[model samples]
Target: MSIVQETPIYRFGDFTLDVTNRELRLGEKRLELNARYFDALALLVREHGRLVAKERFFEEVWADVVVSDSALTQGIKAIRRVLGDDAANPRFIQTVPRHGYRFIAGVSTVARDDTAPLPDGEAAGSPDAASTPATPAAGEAFPSPTRLADRGAAALATALATALAGTLGGAVAGLFGGLLYGFGLAHAPPDPQPGTASILLVLITLSGFLGTMGGFGVGAGIAAAEYAAGGRAAWRIAGAVLGGMLVGGSVKLLGVDAFNLLFGRTPAGITGGMEGAALGLAVGLGAHLGGGFEASPWWRPVAAAAATGAACGVLIVLAGGHLLGGSLDLLARSFAESRLQLDAIGHFFGEVRFGPTTRMVLAAIEGLLFASCVVGALVAARRPRNGLPA
Candidate 1:
């Protein structure tokens, strides 16, 4: 006489892990998982609340095949993505640093007899009674104050991280722009000027400062919007625009006041709120169209960002607004004794001065670089903690 084994179904949170059918489901939706990933998830759920060592995975999940540790890491990342779980603050799968993983969520199991007949009004092979959606158990439906506090803390942490990423990205863009402008001015036709090195250093430092400020404003705005609106795209774009305008306008106002107080003159037609808003709009739209940073193959979002930035840059120049490059040119012209000569850059484009054509060309380049850098940094910052592709 042969004894039959009962199939065990694991229920945790809104997910169901079926051992016999080899399926994972969130409510009625069946999540997509490869054969190996499914096995890995099952292993974690089976050993719920207990650490499953690296050697155990090799023995149980990959017994037939020889694979490296990265394979397991990638599999875990995939599972996390599908489950909408964060490795940093895991509600389901917890990483034990180099040791292995443990499933921390509260799990309940029910065994079913495959050979048993289905009850009336229930189809065969349908979800078992225990698997059906029901009131969320305990802390899920009505969270304790501690759970709410934890969520708020996590959100704040995520926002800060995003803002920091944007700041770094902007600083990089500024450094690049400063170098381009500095080199062009340094190599002007008359000869390399004595103060060219100092000018270069000043430009780099000033540009980097401006970039950092702009990036912080935009990043903080987007993060706040995401938190408040729960990731609505429209709200996010609006946040970006508002944030850019606030930072740009404030900076321009303070700059004008400072110059007037010291030099008794103010530079007009410099980059300000209008330019910031336009760039922010481009970024928000490009990010939306790119389907977010987690998109596969990676280039889709980056290309979209570059295209939008270029278009916005051209439009800003045409509309009589200015970006960093054009604004600096305006400042130089406002002061006759200023050593910042951008004429060489114009000469490269067949213009004797920093003409309209040159401004447009430079604007486009600046926009492209700024958008690409910011978006790339954002993606890099938001990747899974395990450093795997989402």
Candidate 2:
């Protein structure tokens, strides 16, 4: 009689590497990896804590398939990126110069029965069953209730984190905008009745409120998209656009109604659904291009987000979409007795009044600040803390 060996399932950090299923999962999320990359990872994991020489990888992982040294390097790099590990400050993997590599993280193992009873359609000893892949069918992937609950909890946590990041970013952007508008109004030719300090506080408060609303909408959409599609670029962009449009349209409609009811007038050319959608599209595209949620060396995603935001801001201005500054200017113009005036601020942009140049410049600044902060905060939120899952 032959004795069958149980398959080993390795658990390290928050990841589970199931040898039997040939799957790698981080928390409840299944990471997508190439077949060879998966094999390379499996090899490193199987020989955890010990050096895996280059020759051994070629022999075992790339057996009968000739490849260059760069292939191994790229595989390792891809692994690091997926694991969110830094080459300079290695966490899960460590290089042993040109000799070999080691899986430095502590790992635990569990045994899975290979001889377990087959499902109804297949017989255990049949040729078809023997040739069948180990991967679970779509419907059978999450067979346990506990797993579904865990995934739900994880998604909720991620949504909240991204929302918070957006709020923080919006607040920062608002603060900067408030400073510019407040100071400009205070120093206007009319002798500054409200005082710089008072104006600054009011403007800052208003800007912060608007920013918070916008940021939350955008951030929540991103989280939802990521959860639903799992790194698909198109899905993420769609989510962003949907989220931004919903929030922007609702806010604009409400704001206009409120003003019309209170003062029998409404501000025109203010930021609305179209503007929000454009910004959202830009942000989503930037994040996707920058390596989307799981990117390592964190700065790449953040910088990309900022750059895209700046460009979008410029486009919004050129397309006659009003951002916070322009919207505020419109609001001030809507009321004859309104104390708020941004005309004096245009002097900085070489204009006699708050002009297109000033609006465009401020919009760019706002976009850069908002995107960088949101992406940066999200990245920080996703980072593992004290060796624990993020």
CA displacement after TM-score superposition, residue 214 of candidate 2 (Å): 0.5
lDDT of 1 at 385: 30
Clashing pairs in model 1?
Answer: none
Q: Model 2: runs farther than 4 Å from truth?
A: 1-40, 43-76, 80-143, 184-194, 385-390
The prediction achieving the highest TM-score against the true structure is: 1
Best-fitting candidate, scored by lDDT: 1
Worst 10 residues of 1 by lDDT: 132-141
Cα lDDT for residue 165, candidate 2? 73
Model 1 residue 212 distance off true place after TM-score fit, in angstroms: 0.7
What are the Cα lDDT values of the candidates? 0.73, 0.71
For 1-390, candidate 2 gives per-residue lDDT tens digits of 987565566666667788668889887899987666787888787667778888667555544232334457767888899989898999788999978899877655544744233454444223343342233223322336665565567656666776687667666766776776777677766456466787789998987777777777777787787566543567767877787778888889998898889888787888889877876776677676666544556787788988998888999999889888889889888887887778877877788888999899988877777677666766676554211122
